[model samples]
Target: MHPRAGQTKKRTRIQAKNEAKILEAALDIFATFGFRGTTIDQIAQKAEMSKPNLLYYFRRKEDIYISVLERTLDEWLTPLTELDPDGDPIEEIGKYTSLKLKMSQNDPTASRLFANEILHGAPMIEHVLKGSLKNLVDEKAAVIHHWVKAGKLTKVDPYHLIFMIWATTQHYADFKIQMRAILGDDVDQPDYYEKAGQTISTVFFEGIKPR
Candidate 1:
């Protein structure tokens, strides 16, 4: 029988550790080679597990890849879900931008993985995107739309605004090499996220604020 996650039996703790190790290795391999380019053998080798042993946990490579992606997508979009409708829109957007830029710098591999998914039309996350994602955006856009209608903010395309935020924040991840080249190696420093996040928050909040 499958053991409870936290209630690991003698064999289960080791099993859980192995699964985490495998997932970590898989992240690095899949981030570098992408889901289509990676192989079960390569992942097994990276995780230092036998092919059959890895298979004991994950039935297929797709299962592992999808599981990794599910986690990544969940994290990638979490900031948006935290936005409060009653909060000041500027602060809300600023905070979201900061959170996203921080993620871009902190977990670049995960970002690239998600990017690859979207680049391929998000086949794995298409349902989530069309469902939970659309619902959140639709709700948030209405909030922004209401602000504009109430003269609290300048009129802007709510969907486009969201798209812009996503594209801008994710640029640091999706185009890290180019960003590093253009922004220089300081972009990789420990405080880089703080400085970058502040700048993004400034640019977006200032540009979007009403007169």
Candidate 2:
């Protein structure tokens, strides 16, 4: 089960602190090595705790990985899930694009970890992808469809639009090496994410604006 919010039950401050440390370390390790490549020993070491102590909080590697993934997905989906059906469609899309780009800049590793899972066929997160993620996407897709039908947006495939946004926004984080190689020093500049957001928003909204 996911250890999100209330699901984890009550814990003392010390327990919470240790759990947070473990998850943070696990995220770094798992993001770098992925599921198969990562070992419990590595996570324990990164967390600066004994293996048995770490095991006291999380029993298995899979458990830790799933918990990390669940938290990551929940964080990643916040902006998407917040897309308001009542707001201006174009502006909403722009906001979502901006938020996603910011996330790429702020938390690249989580994006890479999620990408790594998908690249490996998403064996670990297949259920959430098919169930909760799909459901949320479908819900938003329908909203987009309504906007198009109402002449708020140009006719476009709602699902593919969302996919394009995901692909374009995440490229900065997932392919930072290639981006850095190509853009050189510019990629490290403070305005990189803002510029990326503008570029992606242009690509997505330019054609889709009601003509």
Candidate 3:
């Protein structure tokens, strides 16, 4: 049987630190190479540890991949989970869009990692997407629909709107190379992201304003 997580009794601080190092290294390798392209050897090298030592914490590459995906999904969805229904709908959504844009700028690797998984049909995380992600989106969509009914937002499909926000925000990270090449050094300017967030929020909320 596969070893259960935390099966080992009372891990020490050094073990915890080493485990974190291994997982962080795994994220970089997996994001760069994708799961099929990455290997335990590469992860071990990235972590600056021997393969045998790395295997002590995670016996297989699959375990490390799953752990990274779980953590990434938790972080990626935090802004969405924090959206407040009690706030002004436009402001709430604008803040969410801004937060996503900031994440795209600050954590492009994580964004691309998630995108890569989705591009490959999410073999490693389809269950989480279909279950936890879907449930969360459904709950938020209800809130959006309520806003629409109350004349706060225009009558638009909330799910599609959510998808649009995700795609637009994530584009900055997944396509940063293309963006940088096209825009030159201007892409590196902080104002570029601020303008992007402002533009995206303006266009979206304005387009969906009650008519």
Candidate 4:
């Protein structure tokens, strides 16, 4: 179902605001309940709006779910999109790693939601995964390869390196419960993210620096 705003009419400020609210509420609901288990009413309640009013923006639960996923993907990929080909390879990669880890630390629900979608085969976003996501990763992978060819980094499979960075950074979010359990209260310390970022950067840089 197309969102009501997509009907060739420019959305008013109020309409836009309501749509944002609905999506934010829907994200929380879908993340907790899974897509199949979430309902339009649940989203409406979360958004603190009437069901009919919420329906004015999103026609179905699936539409809202897809919108939430798309928004998450856009935010999730913004750091990668900013990767500068002309920048120093180690610094650029380190910055990207820190940004990703910060996202995981600050918004673990978004990470777990995305991870769950992928684990279920990404039925709702398979095309996006195959098309835009694959294309973006390919573009960044080339940047990594260029750095290596310029003797800026050690030899490594660019694709696998990208995958490795994603896995290592997102683990903090996707397995927060397990991590907190094992690490005790240290994970809750004020400087935990700072330390994690420094440790990740050090490990990645040490392994990839030309040897």
Query: Between prediction 1 and prediction 3, which has the larger lDDT?
Result: 3
Each candidate structure's count of clashing pairs? 0, 0, 0, 0
lDDT, candidate 4, 1-34, per-residue tens:
3346467877788888899999888888887778
Better structure of 1 and 3 per TM-score: 3
C-alpha lDDT of residue 88 in model 2 = 97
Kindly report which residue stretches of model 2 are placed more than 4 angstroms away from their true locations once superposed: 1-10, 207-211
| TM-scores, one per candidate | 0.86, 0.90, 0.92, 0.88
Q: Write the per-residue lDDT of candidate 3 for residues 100-168, one digit (tens) a residue.
A: 999999998899899889999999999998898999999999999999999998889999989999999
The per-model lDDT (C-alpha) reads 0.82, 0.90, 0.89, 0.87
Regions more than 4 Å wrong, model 3: 1-8, 207-211
Worst 10 residues of 1 by lDDT: 1-10
Write one digit per residue (lDDT tens) for candidate 1, span 29-76.
Answer: 888788899999999999999998898778789888987877677777
lDDT of 2 by residue, 1-211 (tens): 3333455587778888999999999999999899999999999999999998898888788989998999898898888999999999999998898888889999999899999999999999999999999999999999999999999998999999999999998999899999998889899887987787776777776754566
Please estimate how well model 3 matches the true structure, expressed as its whole-model Cα lDDT.
Answer: 0.89
